[model samples]
Target: MRSGQTGDEAAVDVSGGSRRGREMPLEVQHIRDALRREFTSRISMADYEGRAGTDFDNAFLSRALAARAARILTDCSSDEAAAGVIDGRDDFGIDAVAFSASGSELWLIQAKWSDRGQAGFNTAAAHKLIHGLKKLDNRDFDQFNVRLQSLADRVRGVLGLPTCKVFLIVAVVGEGRLSEETEAILKEAAIDFGGWGRTVEHRVLNQAAFHRAVREDLAPEPITIVATMSEGWHSRETPYQAFDGLVCVEELANWYADHGERLYDRNVRRSLGLTGVNQTLVESLTDDPQGFWYRHNGITVQCNTIEQEFFAQRGPSKPVRLTLHNASVVNGAQTVTSAYRAYERTPDALGEAFVTVRIISVNGTPEGFAKEITKATNTQNHMERRDFIAIDETQSLIREDFRLTLDKEYVFKRGEIDPAPASGCSVREAATALACAYPDPILAVRVNGSTEALWEEGPGGAYTRLFGKQPNACQIWRTVLLMRAVRDALHDVRSTLSGRSASIAESGALLIAHIVFQLVGTDGIEEIDSEWESGLNEVPALVEGVLAQLIPLMDHFFGEGSYVTSTFANEQRCQQLVTGVLQALAEGTNVRDLTTFQSDIPKPRRRPSTVSLIIDHNLIPAGTRLEYQPSPTEEQAIGIWLRNGQGRSFATWVDDRRRPLLWEADGQRYSPSGLVTQIWRKADWREAWSAVQGPKQWYVPGEGSLVEIAERLWQRIITEEWSRERETTKDADS
Candidate 1:
């Protein structure tokens, strides 16, 4: 057994190797070097695999490295000498432990290793480590900070002890690629954990550090990538395909743009007869001609910009009349006539000057084509610039509405940050309202004496508690949500009255009210009266904003729906609703105020289309009435015609029944027998809602009984329809 080895370490190692022996010093140094190499190698490979995989494995590598270090410490020191043992509980900061001479100092080492790229060590990784140490939810800044400060206090509580010393050793196994802000945080942590004015050393062992360890034979395994071929391999030709998990420059270029300029030029040149015209010079001119260049088949030829430029620069040199009568290319070369004029030669003097040249065209030159493709693709990154788009008026209002809704309903949740700023116009108003709204804390007293109440525990005690259902958390949460909605609507109304645009103001207020209704029960309005009064000054402004902008825009967006239906009663009902809403707005009261007056009863009732038919008539035959029944879909038309004249069947009744219908004396019954005879007479009403109630006959004009009943029934059906639709939508979402 090793001299410094613990009992467990000794049991693990069969061969005895004592640290107190002469070779102990050399052996310890060798092992440290080996560890350094392993760390460096992990970093390099991890980086190349890319961020996602690299990030995942980096965490895994950190744990593995810590385990390795613990094993090494066990080999170097006895159980008594090892100051800190790894606790399998929720210990996040301390990974491995080391001891000093006094046995007082506790060295806590945390390792961070990544085989991914350097850029992989981002803010998320930093936040993750910190969150773990603080026992807080990740990505939540407020929670993380609160927990972190609490942990710091706990650590500070124990610092006064003489035997206590916490040394945080952050072992980074690669280039430290943490953002500047994150790096500063780690540095600050080190300073605090090690104690002020204490010696705290930091080391960065990179590639060189690993190489030294490997050369000295201190590692357990050698770093190498050994390539081995399969048992039986045969190939004809493997077509071009991308390398797995890798995107080469050529592949990216081809993906973006299929055309390759270099290859195109080569093909064009070979088509024109210029085979033996100095291959290098021809290739150079084809790529980037100095001024102008020409292509010639056996008899036909065409000159481009390069040739034009050259002739222009050199004055009027000879008009080189080169012609190709015929041309063909075999194998690698082409045969055809080609001609060129000297810089000083005149066109007439150089008549008939022509020569035949052979040119070879290469098809499969991947290396050259790939290089060109890379150069072209790389240009895109530099050429492109980002531009910020401004929000349009409609979109801007939408964004504002969305923001209002989110703020009104988004809860910080239990055991998390609260959504309040200490100072502001809204804060003061909200604070006062909240204080009165919840005068006493809502408590969940249990039968047991335990004060701690877990969300999982319900109101029921241990006996039937096993089977008793728990109430929804959303129910308890809705009260507070309603308060938020009321406050937000008030704020928007106030903003609008203070000169904000009409649409903007109304949308903002409406959004707050909508969110509140969605989050909480919308049945009671009296309870929310105090909240409405507080936000009253802003209501009219929001209404005006809507009337001025939103209504006009809606009319334009949905052109056909702007026209009102011809029915007088329908128009009158709509006018009443609109007038009621606008009256509150005119008085500087928003939707919140109206809710108080109206009891917040949601409009638009839901109902089934089919209703059972009930027939009862004094003088009319029941069979005739049953035969004269109208379809459910024709209810609206029947209702409209009934409003105009008593006992007269609507046009739909004539079309559907193919005959006229007669009404009984009570006016509720329809009889088919009297249609052909015209003997059916209109019946007097029983006057159920008359001023004089001794079986008085009804008068149609200026009567409240019949009109009121019709209006009430219409409202009831509409409300039923709306509620049904709302419930259906809610179910689907859940």
Candidate 2:
């Protein structure tokens, strides 16, 4: 074998010349230079420092290649990439491992670096990787080096999740076809682990891909779009050029496939990712393609230059071809992504769909014109399903009734600030509260799944059932208060719980609230100063009592190992759980101890620092975006501040626990609580509370809050400990 070359690396020669005689490709050289510059200090020196000259360089390059793969594929920062590297003597053919921020995928990277850009992934390498995968499957972390062992807990945790996929990334510095034997090895491994779901997959990152990633890292290439728009019209103004037309859904999907999120770099935000609004966009494209253009607000593109290649006569049927240079979608990013997803699902269905397009070229305009256009387009308040409810006559009547009868504000407008806790409630709160209070528990389930269902107007919809009859102001207010009380009580109860129970507390709050409402009885709820006030007062104690019975009942009906989120979201399961709990309550049956549901010993009176716990356990992957959900009081005070284009409601989570949240608004890092306090101060809200539990206020969108994530991790640790203890006991018995 050549010096510094492994057996597998020596076997394949994609390039013609010998390793020492061949000259390095300029792209490969560039990649090498960039990697050394970025990762020399970042990669652990202890791993490769023992070697000299070519050997040292080659080993370091191999580790650097793995880090690069992590950064490029996982979209993680350099720090995370370096931390992910586990390349060493006992690496088990895996150089690095990284998790997607969403926790949906775990990437296992194997890298090969060659000076002449002739790195190869041969049958030997494939077999080694497959053998490593089998060891991982058997939970044999001890076989790997200390670096891999350090991540064993996190790896086990991720692998245990049914939803998380394992991706084997084969990264080589050369471009060549994998041998049939090598391909077979990977395919057989994937099949062995795949079972019912595609649990394992592989991707090859060749030299060309590496080059693209390197170039993108240095400076992103500007996105250029070639669009053929029908019914196109141009603005006659001099300072800037603008075009208005209709673009086919197919074209938008193609752009998304090619450019992805690069198309939204200049936008205020990236695609919101399957939000309720975006889901509706997807539904429209798939279900009613022809009507999508009429129902949807079209996309706006900002470009450096626009050239009309072909223009037909001034008829609606004629198509005009335009080439847009350095283009970015400033608005309707959600629409574009949604279209892409919808197209992916049902490509044939979207042929009839078209979206209106507005393209603007600020090439000759003022310095800030492009920015101004981006700002203006995004600043305008867009309509949601709830916004349409604000226009309803019944909602107006409720607003008037609150003013005339209760002397309180009942804000129904989408952008309007929610009233203070003591004063009144918004339509959203009222809807959710009323949903829980409704006779059928499925409405509450729908609300828990997505609040959008509350505005869905139809015979069977929650909106019609709750608001179709124009519920009285007193009923709305009382139920809203009751729901608030249930939530507050549940939040306290949730803090004491861990594992699936904690998840149940978070996801099944509405269900629990609905159950509490049922037990309290809904008679005289509409009457002022009625017995319902006493029931509302009993809520805190009632919530605890109900949950004590309800949680145990859920485990009995649904298996103890069942996913709490899916259980609560499923209408049938929730209905069954509610029935079982209510029946037990009515019969005065003895309930299981709440301790049976507890996954860990009681937490200390002084809560551990969230940042420390998160970093210690590696519960959240780096570069995850956490969303800010203001406390009820803070929401009332800073609604305008949050909405004022300040980017106040989002923060990127870094690995640093002391200052985990990198605030997007000011480009500064702060502790979760510290950031909340800062926002309060910046908003000039004098009434801000002295104490803030920041983890409770920030969430990872689809995932739970920081507190919840930490609790789950703790629960997993305790469960694993118990399982080990049980195994030991079984062995002793044997």
Candidate 3:
């Protein structure tokens, strides 16, 4: 209805006839009814305006409408009053304010009733309400007592505190009119504004822009309104023609939280996936009757496809649009009524409406149970049926052997399946009987087939007689063949993994094979181990042989003979292998414990003495002299000479260029407590053999005297020859 038009201008006669001389009054009443109806229908939300008016008139008109809405709300005389106000200095834009009867409770609302307005209005309103509510919460944020009169001031404030209850409400009166979509929003707001174990009374007034007409009205009652001059939304379920107001933040938060489930249900119903809770009637019909039904967020008006489509095309003509389709049985009765106006009472109050449906029970044997049910009404009755009726009171009662079904003239919806025939036997029982008699013949496979004739005839003759009712032989055979192949393949994989041929040597392949075996072992397996090996003794044997070869090879090159040969050779080696094998183990265990090696050395009574030695000698007495000193810095020059001289100190040599005494010296020395082994010094060399050879070998050679060894040694002879040339030049010069 226009802002200037009276309620009479807004309605049209829904009833076909017009009363004599009552046209004007009727139109006025209809307009009033229409205005109320339209206002109520859209009370849940605000309408969408894609663009804002850029001109001053548009802006002025907007403000005017908002002011008018505020006036209407304030005039409502509800427990609360609401209005919209725009603060020029604020960036938050328009807000709505609601005041309770005593002006103690304040509800602040921020509205974005257009696409370009904002999605954060609800969030912003919630924040404001949360802040305001917290103020009323009597909490002290400054617990540190930083202020001079902190404790004292608080004590005084508490003592002087007045008895007052103020709740902050925030809500988003969404664009696009009040609708079921706002159901979730309302629930969320209720929870939030309801405050600290208490409930907040709230309502959302979703209205259209000034130029737009009220969409529709469907609320059960008029909502309490609070008017205030703040830029925000309104809370009245009734639409105030000029009001574009705000809702409380507490309202927004509560509505969001509570209605999330319903929104989720709606989205699930909108999709066609086989999964999800079957909450929607549409989904339930299309899905297998025995299959699970998915649930939707909310119960949409229980409707069939045709009625829903019709409403979609015509727009909402009533608060609820429900079409009662004839009669159907639920439990065991035929008391379903054809009266379709029952839903006019309320959306959530359908349970109170009386509905009659026929209920039928088909328990095997000839006799069955039939019932006429009239629930939500005075009369209800049931009785046994001696004979089944083809048409039972404009409804059909079809008794299939073991089951009974009741349905009025079948109305085929988009995804409805064909119903089972009205056979004398139940579908399952009939199928089972046919399968038994028609073991080979196709004609005998049908429900009403002749078993005797099929036995006399062949597959071709039986199939010819059966025609459309006969089972397709090709399809059956193919299905059976495929199943057998899959089963066999699964078994083969199982056999492979359990086979003795499963070797860890091919670790990657073996691991994959083992995984395959597990996947196919649904029925479980027997004789888990392969016949190839009863025990894993060979594995250890092979590992030992390989380790034996590697140990000696490593020892020879590194000059450490007992690296690791026998499995029990050393605890260190065993530990190394164990650590390698179980490296993936968590860091908590001690790695050294896995070793087999045990130390043979006794605990020290006293630390052993370690000694260093030097040997000084001359190869050619008085002509060319060779000397060895343990001058680590100078030892490189005389290392070989010291060793060959049978010099005991030379044993310390490791290499001629590095440490040459390791090959030659040996001795014993007495410390304060005991005798300790040491290398011989330069003083211990035997000078008697000085003239016997050119130079002594650093290492002990398998030979007797000096010259005897020189003839067998090429390196010694080369050294002697070089020394002679140098001496001749020195003597000639002298």
How well does each candidate superpose onto the true structure, as a TM-score? 0.18, 0.63, 0.17
Candidate 2 TM-score versus the reference = 0.63
Predicted structure with the largest lDDT when compared to the true one: 2
Model 2: per-residue lDDT, tens digit, 1-734?
A: 22334766543233434554457778888888999998975676453334566656777788888899888776678979998898765677888998765454578988888777877888878877776765664445655656676677677555544334578888888884688888898887665554211257788998888888888977889999987776545454465678888889988999998987778889988765555566668877998999999887788999988877556464434677879999999999889988897887799988899988899988888888889989999988687778787678999999999998899999988779898988999988999999999989989887776677788888997899999899999999988888889989988787677645665666578889999999887789888877768767788887877887877776688665444544666677778888888888788788656656555544323335667778887878899999999866777889888999568899999988578999999999999999999988998999888888898788998767787666556545543554686799899999
Tens-digit lDDT track for model 3 on 1-734? 11221222211122213431243343233323443333322121111113322222222223332333332333222112221333111212223343322222233333322212111224333443344333222122121111111222332222111111222222221232333434454455444333211233333433332122122122322111111212222222122112122222222122223221122121212121111111112122223222211221111111011122232333322222222221112221101110111121122333222111111112221322112211222132321121111122211211221132222123112233434433132222222222322323222122111122222223454323322243322222222222233334334332332111111111112112222222222121112232322222233332322222322323343233221111112223333433333332224233332112212323212211111111122121221112222333224544454566564332332212222233323432222111101222233433222222112322232322222222224223333544685699799999
Tell me the lDDT of model 1 at 610: 14
Candidate 1 Cα deviation (angstroms), residue 327: 85
For residues 637-724, what per-residue lDDT tens digits would candidate 1 score against the true structure? 3435444564444211211222323244234322233331121122222222223211011212332222222333443443455468
In model 1, state the lDDT of residue 493. 46
Worst 10 residues of 3 by lDDT: 332-341
Ranking by TM-score: 2, 1, 3
Error of 3 at 210 (Å): 7.3
Worst 10 residues of 1 by lDDT: 382-391
